[model samples]
Target chain A: MSTTEPDNVALNGPVVGRYRVIPLIEKGATAGMRPAVASKDVQEALALPGTLVADWQDKAIKRLGQLVKQRRGLRVFLDNCTKCGACTDKCHYFLGTRDPKNMPVARQDLIRSVYRRYFTLAGRLFPWLVGARTLNKALLQDWYTYFHQCSQCRRCTVFCPKGIDTSEVTMAGREILASIGLGQQYSQEIITKVKSIGNNLGMKPRALADVLENLEEDILDDTGVPVRLPLDDSRADVLLVTPSADFFAEPHVDGLIGYAKVLHQAGVRWTFSSQASEAANFALFTGQHDHMRDIALRIRNAAVDLAVSRIVIGECGHAWRVAYSYLDALVGPLDFLDPAHSRVEHICEVTHQLLTQGRITLDPQRNAGKVITYHDSCNVARGASMGQRAGGQFRIPRELLAASVPRVVEMSADTTKQKTFCCGGGGGLLTDDMMAVRIKGALPRAQALQSVVDSDEVTHLVAICAICKTQLSSVLPHYGLQHVQVTSLHHLVGDALVL
Target chain B: MLGYLLTAAFVWAVAGSAYRLIVWARTPSTLPMPLTPAPTSRVGVVGRLLLELLTFRALARADRTTWLASLAFHYGLLLILIMHLRFVWSQLPPSLVPFIGLSGWATLMLIIGLSVLLIRRIVIDRLRYISSPSDYLHIILLLTLAASGTAMKRLWPVDLYGVSQFLQGALRFSWQPLPESLVLVVHLSLVLLLLFVFPISKLLHGIGIVFSPTLNQRDAVSAQTRVLSGSSHSKTRE
Candidate 1:
């Protein structure tokens, strides 16, 4: 294969450099990968009673009006984009797919333009002149095609001069689409599963108990320690509400193993509640506020029923964001939980404290074979904090990694911390149909990881979010760096824990 | 006739701005969407807003060229606004007299800043793609206002005493004939048009920044225990 000149690389195609900058393209409705439409069963599960309505367009317009009245962020964001282009180059999807519509400002304008035509005087008088368009069938199709492209990662909000959050706009657009009976099948299906089976994967209580039993057997055989992964034990001091993926997915299961080992060594009494086994709430992804509240209420009820004083969440990025930021607001007066400790604590925060306080010891040499780097999952990095400090989400995880690993190298500074890129599989776009979007969107992150691998001999890419772990694991091979293993931050901790 | 139009524009601008503020205020922010490493206290939020307002700190951190142009444009407008106080007040404050003389410099800065911003929107690939006709029109309008105001100041000087008398008369609800210079008339008309559009267009960003949830909300989630509404879940949990 002849290598093309770097300068000759097309703007709308991938570039090879220190970091690959994907060229801009017009990836409209048929971008080779579109999310499946939400089925009727999924609609009923989400309590969206109007899914079968014939007048969806009118209903959508009315729903948009109601949302604008309720949410100040939606109204203000619709008004505030000066289109300064600061956020144009900031989106990972824009960087990866090279689609201009993937740019945060343009993505927001998809809905903003419709809002203007209906709401603003200028748009009503001269729609074409102001780039405003009527909310037609074409516009709604664009909303589905483009809004799904956004990971709802708020990286663009950090650099925004007006602090206009595009995620809020994306959520509003998704909500409007859902109101009119159009919803992405992935998030909708997951919500239905969580509502009925108490987890996204729909693994029943017996399956969950069986997985825990197998995990216990493997841990005992390997580590010579009989660490119990207890379930529904009301007497426990802490309740662990983790993503269902931790019980099923590969690297994610290892992260769960780490949590079990840390809890075992710390001598803390923690149990998983079967009633609220899953922490990942896909309702947030679909912007169904009522469904989000209903899912969170299950956790609150479980905590009350179990009489657990403190609730600790596992390594799920958006789940932690919901737990830390929105849980209290949605279903709270969590006054029953211990106020001295955070009502909900990240598993990393707990493990980091244990390591620092000498309550749990780790031998970094156990992980000495691998040189590691951490990917700041966008939701946890920008949307939530870990400990009391402002950027504890970024710091606490790295601290745990450094304590557990022999050597650690950070990815490019621009691509880490508050300005981190998404792992291309968030915001409920992790279905098989959206594989093309997922792969292209992973380019920017893959390029950043590639840089560290080339220079620092980094062997493993660590992530805290299950989606990130799975996405990176699948996409890293396409970048010609398949040897680089995608592992979890807790997986390393578990390896080094001196049991 | 020109005096009445200017008065009407000013009234519309003020009333429209009040309505915008009321709309924003009436819409409740049910969730705390503060972008973190955000301030966790009320005082900290004030400090954050002050820094953002005075320096455009966030923009500066994101892109320096845009930050410099925006900072110069806003500060230049502030200086020109202060100089306009000479028209309303019978006796200019002694401290302000010295700065009023710098109107020449302020005018130059305003034009230069507007030109830089206009050039950026025109030449930058990303910016040019996003620019609507109105975005360009906004800058063009401001540029014309700056140019006409500057020409009247330096090239074809207007009767300042007569203009001030007309402004003072208008303030006191009395009609006075506007200055008979073409440059002065154009300048005043342009200013009126800007005010008319200020509350209606993206220009509402001036006030929108203060109410920005990300910039203004405190990040004190741990301190406040949210009281849920009396929904079925509340009773079910109990």
Candidate 2:
């Protein structure tokens, strides 16, 4: 991206945060983001209170106490923040809304205030001094409005001096809300679908099979090969667990096609299971440990049932974060599977390995007209990894882009790696209800993209995460770069794969 | 006696910080939530954390002004704390005696550091909004402490031997006359109050950083290696 070094502000160098990254004091820009439709009766599945109880405040506090005791990260984050403001402007929501509460530290304070009142000695003695507040209906409302504003992207965590990840605080807040019979409809419904129908769209086995069949026919028409999209194949060597969005949505489905083409070219047998159909775990958004465990178990069960040796997580950001970072803890050990492979594998890791070994070749000229820049999805960049190195998550996608696309331009160094911005719609905030937050949140990425479009003449923007694709596509036009459409990293790969 | 007040503050600060540290360690980490591009090894994590603690490196990247002010304040605090060991310790370790001589300039550094932080809190709307009354009180308290400490250092010129003897007596539970200077009394009283509030206030960040999952965690996530990484991951609720 062409970073504009404003002469007045750029005293020495063009800092990444020179323009529009700083919060401009727009109070209530995000305050009215609205409570997402709370889930109905579905709370029973998560063993939550079925409805708002008379003792809802007590229930929420009790749940917070349980979470603090159960989750050390949450307890420590609540205790550790110094209000140094390192993370004050780090949140995209805060940048977008300028609502001070949208700031990560302030958003965290929504619950930490309650934590102080109940748990800390200073808050109990002199609540005003520590910004502590007792539980109340109005304050609980603030908990929902502000915490939901967070995408749980972990962007703020990167810059926090204490490394206090506000996402953990947001997750804990959501968990407390659910305990008091308040839950996000978007996340809860998705979790219920994964629990009941095996996918987020509630796509029954027949529907999923039909979609795969259509995808296979499309691949055959395009490539003139009998490339198959295998479903529940018992003889498969790899189990491909991907977000259902990739099975149905544009750009996302192209990534699915890319996976199949690569697997077919590499001569590796892989299959997708309707049972473990969803790689995107909504339980992560809800912060329900038991539900997160149960959802991840479906993958373990599917691997066992399908008799696959390896499980490859698809190109969804948060899904990869869960699969790579939390799968072992959530689903127990992978001893049942083959030991030669990693316990959990990212789809990009698998594809990168193939590209490295010359198992497949790409004709970069196939994407000749497109100048591309990669958007490092937040969850994968900060919450997950690829290859064997620490920053492999950032490297592998760009490497894939470079190998597959002819003209690849790097976005701002600041916004491309661990400092990447969220796609606004992650953390289960991808529903229609949070459109305002989504649009505002997309501003920083949109500006970064506009700079690239102006300087590098970058035409196509590509990202690995499904949420980033969908969010960027929907939101970029609002910022005047309507010509820029977000595509999948593997879409380019599918385009360039030399048959 | 002032000894009892000093003892209470010492015991509370140590016990409170330790108590929070212990609770953080005991609670289940549940998942590996390392902010990535994170170090993949324990040594790497330590090195990165040390850089952050020592330099406020992340703040340098996020906001340069905060980093400069914070670096000055914290390092200044460290140096000033060490300089005070002249009064606290019966005798300085032979090596530290050399560094203690830098206390004159370190006081200026401390005042400058605290001033920038205080001014930012007063001027920056964002910081002003995020800061509580106690945040202001903290800066004011520390600034006043520095001013009074400076007055004793240069203006009042209290009996150094008597003050050192008084501190040693407080630690040993054998009282000694605290050099009978109003400035010394003001400085010591503020120091005692700071210690008493350190653990209860946001100052817990001093200890909490060690147990912070995002900072202390390694980037590598293997189910088999989960034990070494997430130490308290045993699921008790389930």
Candidate 3:
């Protein structure tokens, strides 16, 4: 909110009216950083000039240069391409949007040009010779727009012979752009809320407590069962958490209802804490590593404080990837969190196991007559090694979908395992502001669904990721798709619960 | 002049490099994976062909300025290849002789342009930051090949007729020994080096991009564009 004048392209500049913006710290160059004054007043702030500046100067610059090298290196992926187009017919978004640029090769070239100009000999010496473009403000905007269009989905890599990862490039682009202070406002706003209120929804402990109290009342009205949605209860056996969207939104709330019903039926000793309740981390989308780490820290600390046995994540896709892939490395060896006491399971996986064991009877007809198809969230299916594993762990979602709706059909060119298209929302491009790309990016998936709708008369779109659900719901209508309601895999379980 | 043994080796090396470049340029032929089938029909085929020729990438608009320089380098490189080809025939087709001579002169200008460009990469700090070891090696390779090949063809034409006859005999598989020459040796060595380096380095992308999922995608899916600028997308505060 500070309206201060911005500073130089390099080195320390003026802080936005209040906080002092330190010189862009160069990695390996040990630039000294003075502690920010606790007081908000700018003039009273202290400065640690010479030594601090010198420390980080060379190192930070070197790191930036290294990033440029990686960008330049990606061009090999660009130039060596055979244009055989083997993977073209495979992308779900392309089927959905009909845009040529959505294809993986075209998508990567945008980022590759910047890499060439700054990193390659030809691009550097004869900048006009090798098609290398300089990275300026306008170019930065194009990258942000185009990179966001990719959901960090690994579908292209699965089809690619060399396994070139567009997601990695998108992440790199985000970080490089962020270092230059060119982050999007929507993601930035959410990060601000996470930093200030401890949750992406700006839900502090007290606000979350109120929401839980209301949720308990709603559960009583729906099932006539007095279920207590516990908050901040210490020493609970299982710590269950979900995206804030579920608590306030439709059908997702029903999905939450299903979760409560399962816990009660099984007599599982699980608790939901208001203090660290959010499972959705938008920071992952914006490439805000520290923000993501902070969110993870709160979750870990809360679980440790309560002495929970296992942490079960609700039906949020990328959050689970961040949890499974990064949390252990980023916030753990939580010697404090006993390994035996801490395990993360996707809700669908847990529910499917419960059903397979015959602990819960499923009513097949509850979801009857709905020709249903499933959209694999990129994080769980593509980025993570969950569905791709050779044995049973990967097949859990497919089996559950089939069992729930007897009419489950596979989406076209759908990568069941490591290959999956991003929902155009994975990197946090899910909001209405990114609707143009979401509309285009979702085309491949929608087109696949349309085939089922026309040929098989499918009616429902089942998804495991909340972002995918949100994105598909908005995109389907644009294509004249009907009655294809998007809901979590578990909500279907709650419907078929044979109580 | 070196012995006939060196000439034979030099000719063999140049042939190998030409084989590699052609393979690198036309990677669709050796594909180990499934092919997306090049777009069919007059419009699609013509569009596809043009894209192939120009390496047309919409996202590459940033490199619009480099088009002329790249055209010069590639055109020069292509011309030099044709001149070498003319040597393989005993009697140059009367019509092609003038074209070959023009291409020989063009190669000289291209080498000078490329050298200037390579030096720029080394001197510019921003450009230097991202450059890799192979990038420098590639520039050196091309320039060296051009310079050496130009010298052999225009400056020193020692036993030019005998060299042409030797090349024709090799092409015919008669196994004739090549005429001894230093410029030809250096040019052939550089060309061979470029070949061995192709598969391992970024040069590999020349074959890889065609199979790039983005370009080859058969689906008509459009990715949604972002409404917000990246500069405003700060999700974390340091």
TM-score of each: 0.94, 0.94, 0.62
Kindly list the per-residue Cα lDDT of model 3 for residues A319-341, writing each as its tens digit: 77777556765676655433433
- RMSD of each predicted structure: 5.0, 6.4, 15.7
The reply for model 2, stretches above 4 Å from the true place, is: A1-21, B222-238
**In model 1, which regions exceed 4 Å deviation?**
A1-15, A18-32, A49-53, B222-238
Model 1, position A11, has a per-residue lDDT of 30
Worst 10 residues of 3 chain A by lDDT: A29-38
> Least lDDT summed over 10 consecutive residues: which range in candidate 2 chain B?
B226-235
- Which residue pairs clash in candidate 1? A11-A23, A24-A98
DockQ measured for candidate 3? 0.05
lDDT of 1 by residue, B1-238 (tens): 8777777777889899999999998899997888877777899999988888788887886787888888888888889999999988878999899888888888778878888889988987677777889899898998899899888877999888889888887667686898889999899889888988888889988678888898888777744543211111211232
- Model 3 residue B147 lDDT score: 70
Cα lDDT tens digits for candidate 1, A306-422: 887778899999998899889889997798876555468889888887777788998999987899999999889877887676688889998888889999999988889988889
On the 0 to 100 scale, the lDDT of residue A269 in model 2 is 77
In Å, residue A212's CA in model 2 sits off its true spot by: 1.0
- Chain A of model 1, TM-score against the native? 0.95
